[model samples]
Target: MNILVLKMGGSILAKLPTSFYQTIVALKQQKICEPIIVHGGGPEINETLKELHVESKFVDGLRVTTNEVLDVAEMVMSGSINKKIVANIQKQGGTAIGMSGVDGKTLQAIPIDNASTLGYVGQVKKVNVSWIEQIMEHGAIPVISPIGIDGSGERLNINGDMAAAAVAKALKAKLALISDIPGVMENVSGKEFVHEQLTKEEIEEKIASGVIYGGMIPKVRSALNGLSGGIKESVILNGLAPEDIKDYIQGKQAGTKVVMKKEEKQHV
Candidate 1:
């Protein structure tokens, strides 16, 4: 089966129209591809922390996860945000199962900094794809939260993009990183146009030339990392554009396809 891992950032989740979920359901129902959702809850987690009067800190874009912060993060990501996405899919007539990486040891991880500077932040050391496959066998889409478990049985906060990339690599699936914008855009003679496809070397050259800057640099880098880790391909897609989802599935032009090499074609 053609498997597509969709990574949605929390910032855009709330703003995504109901049509987004419907498109996903339609794709699965049509057997276009097996779609798995891995999501983040950054904005919601920040809101929850603020409401609870907990101090949130960040170092180099990673949240400095203390025990207290980890608790809130898990509560928001695994508890609320995870179910919301599942419910949205169900409402669109799709079978969906919501879970955290801690469930079934799906994402076995180790602390990124040995629990010193980054505290409970972890990087995925291993991915158990069996459980995810089992869920898929039941005709349900798996909606995963980024909270992971360490070998010592400690729950660790994982970067959502990193977690999603790990799952894509494990499944050997194509990854679709849903973003607010259409895709990576560059200015040519004062006109901006999205690059339909990019390679690792091109992406780096664009970054160095300031064509890819600010927030997009990290996103493209994440896509490059997924490509390097054995994912067939990764694309930056617009969550707001539901039609793009179908376009991507049908092997039609839609978003910016990021590949390891210039001549690499999408397996799906």
Candidate 2:
């Protein structure tokens, strides 16, 4: 079965309409692709940290996970946010099981930097794809939290986009970086529009020109990483539209498809 890895951004999780969940169900029922979700919970974690008077910071688009911050991140991501996504899918009549990367050692990790600078932040060293395959075989979507485990059994914070890229590479699945926006946008003559397709060079140029800045930079970079890892294609698309997923499955252009080079065509 072909797999499609959907990377859900935390900023837009709560705002996602029921139509988005319906798309997941439709995909499964039609056997278009077996969908697996890896989600983020950044805004929620930051809110909780603020409530508890804990200082939070970021370095190079990754949250600086101090021990105190790690505790709250685990709670927000693996505990609350994980189950919330599962429940939302269930409410829309889709089967979903939520689990953290630490569960069954699905994601093994090593620190990205010394703990003195960024406490407990790690990159994925290994991914045990069996856990996801089992769920997929059972006709259920595995909604994964990006909290990884290190060698010493310590919980490590992972960037959700990075986690999704790693999982897609492991499964050799296509990737979609789902967010609230329609796609990569450009202000042409003061009117903004989604750029239906983009190559790595175009993405870099846009970033340098200030057209693609902030959160979108990390997303496109993650997409580039997935492409380099041999995933057929990666996309940045909105989850808000009712017909977006259907369009994608039908080979209709629905969002900004990322390619490694301009000469490359869109691949499955």
Candidate 3:
């Protein structure tokens, strides 16, 4: 069974073209691959929180999730955003089930740090792969929200990238981080070129030299984490491109492929 985990970033969700949904449909209906969608809802959560007069703040990109904040996060992530993705896929003739990591303990996590400043943010410690596999076996794509449950059964906000990485590792599936950017690009001969393939050391060197900065840092780090966690391959690709997913499924050079080592290019 070929499984491809797609992490759809919140920033690009709204702007994604209809063709993106069509590609997802093709994946399932055409038997291209079993698609698992892990999505983020940061902007929606912030908007909802602002409407409810809840103070919203983030420390190092992780939202500070108090009880009130967690409530709104659940509503926005699981209720609104998750269904929106499902509806979009269904509209394109694909079967999709929207769910949260809290449902059936799909994602179990522990506090990222004991520091109270970051509040209820959690890092994934376990993923209920059986449940996800069941959904896929039923011919439905699981559109997962990143809310997690803790040891005491408290709901925790899991970073979408981290959540996706954990899911990929647990499923032993390929990971594709959907981003607005095409891929990791650098200036060469005064022109920007996306590195079609990258290894851990090369990614680290570029980061150290400030080539891969800002939001791309955590994304690359998350991809690296997936590779280290037994995922065969990971990539950062443009979600807007119609052929990107198809190309990735065909093992073609469509985006930046993340690898464990430079010589481990057999898969790419």
Q: Is candidate 1 or candidate 3 better by lDDT?
A: 1
**Candidate 1 local lDDT, 161-240, one digit each (tens):** 88998999899888999988899998899998999999899998989998899989878987887776578789999989
Residue 60 displacement in candidate 1 (angstroms): 1.3
**What residue runs in model 3 are displaced by over 4 Å at the alpha carbon?**
228-230, 265-268
Instruction: Give all candidate RMSDs, comma-separated.
Output: 2.2, 2.3, 2.0
Runs of candidate 2 exceeding 4 Å displacement = 189-192, 228-232, 263-268
**Candidate 2 lDDT:** 0.87
Clashing pairs in model 1, backbone N/Cα/C closer than 3 A: none
Number of clashes recorded per candidate:
0, 0, 0
Mark the regions of model 1 whose C-alpha exceeds 4 Å error after superposition: 264-268
Worst 10 residues of 3 by lDDT: 259-268
- Candidate 2 residue-wise lDDT, 1-268, digit = tens: 6788999878889888989999898898789889899998989998999999999998766678888999999999999999999998899888999999999999999988666688889889989999899998888899999999988898999878888888998998878988778888888898999988898999989999999998788878878877875676799878999478778866798988998766545597
- lDDT for 20 (candidate 1): 95
- Using alpha carbons, what is the TM-score of model 1? 0.94
lDDT ranking, best first: 1, 3, 2
How accurate locally, in lDDT, is each candidate?
Answer: 0.91, 0.87, 0.88
